[model samples]
Target: MTRPIQINNHPFRFLLYLEWILLAISVITSVLPHPSPRFASRFPELAILNLTIFGLMGLRLPTSNNLVKIIYTACGISLIFITGLFGGRADRLFPFLYIILVIRSCLIFQLPGRLSVTFVSFTLFLTTLLYRIPRYPLPPQAQEKFRFFTLSLALVFGLSLVFVLILMNTVLSERESREKLAIANEKLRQYALRIENQATLEERNRIAREIHDSLGHSLTALNLQLETALKLYQANPDKAQSFLARAKELGSKALQDVRQSVSTMRSNPLQDKSLAQAIDILAEDFQRSNNILLNRQINLEYSLSTEVNTAIYRIIQESLTNISKHARATEVNLEIIINRGSLYITIQDNGRGFDLEQNTTGFGLQSMRDRALSLGGKFTINSAFGCGCQITVDIPLGRLIS
Candidate 1:
């Protein structure tokens, strides 16, 4: 025996096992004739043993290994032989044992292998019929006629059982295929949902950076200009008027920029332009409006995804905003270079910086870091309280470049 057949408990498999139990019950019931032989006294012990062996074919254990399957198959084949050889001439239903054997063989073996089992079953039934003919006290004419009818009926039943087994196998194979397809579709749906969630989170971070960069920077600059105007009210009357007028203009521009950021998220001062062009415009405006010295060197000459382009622009904007708010510097230098599919940005300012470890409570540094990370970039700040501040952002450009 190669191995035991193992199958899931589908309706068809249950029927395969259940059929043997029903067949055994049928044979045992018919063993003792009702008129002359009732259930208790008329049924022979040998016939009862035959029914027990047939029912054992359908016995299911908790776990069946190769050894268990081998033993089970041997017992089923043995029952067929025992029934034909010793089931007695009075038990005319011994041919039914061949039907049970053929069905069990179909479940365990392939087509060629099961055909071997079928041939053996036919030979055994014919030999048993010949053996019992002499024992039956029938004359030559009646014995010959009985042998012909028994062989013809067994042949017909065997072919019909083979056809039914083939149909059951086809149905079970189709059911297994449909179940695999359903599992694959569910995995694809879960993967799509995860991608959508990640995109939503990145968009939220982009918007936060935008609001902080444009509006926050403008408000800080406007507040500084107004303070200068207030102190110069009596000492320098004409300069105070000039400073106030510039503060009012900056306030109006800040309001417009905020509206533009909200109305069209993609519509920045950098609309329809390259990232370098956008950053240049931002630097010029900050220098002219605040009367601060700004120097920039940028080399972004390739097309990239909108999200990446937008992320880079906002990172620069947020860095500039933080400098304006906290850094009391005279000159700032911004350098951007793209090399080997990676963009590097470094901003250095000659300002009084704070301790990185102690003053770790603001959202400006955190916002810049978040923007860089969202776009597969890295952000690093190098500074001290007395010395100056240097901010570097490195972003990989291979994945999101357009």
Candidate 2:
């Protein structure tokens, strides 16, 4: 069974109320005195029948079933024909029934269907006028006046129908546009939420890498120094004291690394330093902490943005940390140069390298790769067992500055 139309929830509740008011007036007008006494009393009953059919059709309203709509419309047309032929009534208010039919058609149909229904209603109205004209015979003296009045009434009704069609179409089109805009806003909200989640995850991973590369390495070296100092305490007093000093230094370095990592979380890694100055500090710290020989050649002629500076600095720092922790390299080469319209960076180490495929998923390597890619650059690492590893990055300069 079809569900009943919920009038309270309808968008056009005002239109429905207007329909009721107009139909009530029409029924009241149909019962008044007329020239033809034969059907004067029955006209009220016919008007009541029309109202009953309208009420019945309203129950089946807001439906998608084409057959149901067509049947209801036919019933309305049939009532119009009966009123004109048998009742001999084509009064001024009668055209309102056809207008009501057009209103209902607007609710049920699209543009093409609406136009078709309006055309049919107008045509039926003309037919009703012609059919009732002969029955209500005007005298020859008033015939011209009656003809002019009839033509004026028809023209007015026609214009009213056109105005209603345009108004209903405009209202429906605006409602549809608002609905589509609401849907688009919801989709954009979901997309922004997803982007926020992804950024949060990446930040957490970066913090993890920073902690591992800085505090982790310093603590490990501190532990080894303490062990060495314990072994030499009794055997050699001077060496034991020196080792103890180095252990204290390592402990201080670990604390400093923690503070730096905290600062990095709150702001950019380089703070206010130039990329060249930041790299120099990183190189000095690495050499002071390890017994590895480092060679550097940096050539940056143009000023770089904070994002580009951070990317370059972090990539170099991560590389140095990885080499100190696992590479077992004695010598490392670092180079940064700008050529044509691109920045190129290369880091090579004479370390006992592991298989590249096996270690590609390491946090340090992934972090460097993410930084390079974020700068719209390419990062490639090549390594083999017992051979040195080389990492090269190339970033375009044109779009970066622009």
Candidate 3:
């Protein structure tokens, strides 16, 4: 696999420049002052050639192909062989070749490939040592000098490899951490957006329910009174006058109710009443207005949090309004039960019912289900032609009943 090149930070770049400066100084010190014409001509030329290759490697050119590796290996082998031909005098610069090989291995290869390059470089160093020992005579003073050179070479190569590996691992670790944090932040944003949308939808449903319950019913009652007055005017003048007066009174009351419903629907109603109480008021008003009997059986007394209460009340109000408008029912039954950390509510009407599956897309039923789901609740409706409609809502207590 081809690895991307990363530009190092200022401190690391400074260290790299320092290494190149040191290599230049070593080459200059090894070559100057014209020691024997044959040694001077050949050795300095070879040292200059090796330094040039090191400079090229530092530029960080692309190495997706094996051409760069072949060039680097050939240069390394040539420098090692040339230094060996010069014997003990040139052997002092062997550490430079080791340093360059280790760095090139790290840049060109990943961990496993770097290890293979390291093993090969060490083998070449051993071969150079064995070749030199027989040609140079070991005097007592030169024995300690040879040992020092060997130790220095080992220290430079070993320490450089260890430090480079540590630096690469640290960079990889930091990159992975940043990626994970980015993913987590994205998920949090999505969750927050979902919550905001649900809140807006619940508020809209509340306003719609208030319109149907308070304003819609009153307007319908006023309309009925007006129709009655128009009929009575031909039969009896006094009765028609009384009916007209009642119609005017009903219209004025309805206008007031409309204003009140608009104001309250904009704000929160659950701040004044629990969810169950809100449902009870709605059922009672509906019962009184339509002259229909309501059988309410509630076993739960717990008050839900404000938002949860608002959602539940809207759902119940919508279900009852649908019954009043379309069901043509004489009696409706409402049952609420809370048990084992679950809130269960069922509303049924003894009226002409339509197919639940086929007519599932009706506005009132969809609104009720949407309200229940917004609170993390489940809603189910069951009905068939000529049979009563039943709606069941089950909400987890942890989510809404608290």
Give the range where candidate 3 is weakest over 10 consecutive residues by summed lDDT.
3-12
- The sequence of per-residue lDDT tens digits that candidate 3 reaches over residues 290-389 is 5678898878767667877777776776777778678889999998888888899899998899976688997667777877887788999988778889
Write the residue-wise lDDT of candidate 2 on 5-27 in tens digits: 55755668888888778766766
Give the runs in model 1 whose Cα sits over 4 Å from its true position: 1-9, 13-168, 219-267, 274-277, 288-291, 299-308, 337-344, 354-381, 393-402
Which candidate order results from sorting by lDDT in descending order? 2, 1, 3
Per-prediction TM-score: 0.64, 0.85, 0.67
| Candidate 1 lDDT tens digits, 357-376 | 97655778888788788778
In candidate 2, residue 4 scores what lDDT?
Answer: 40
Task: Give the number of the best model, judged by TM-score.
Answer: 2
Candidate 2 lDDT: 0.78
lDDT of each: 0.71, 0.78, 0.69
Error of 2 at 237 (Å): 5.6
lDDT of 2 at 365: 89
- Give per-residue lDDT, candidate 3, residue 290: 56
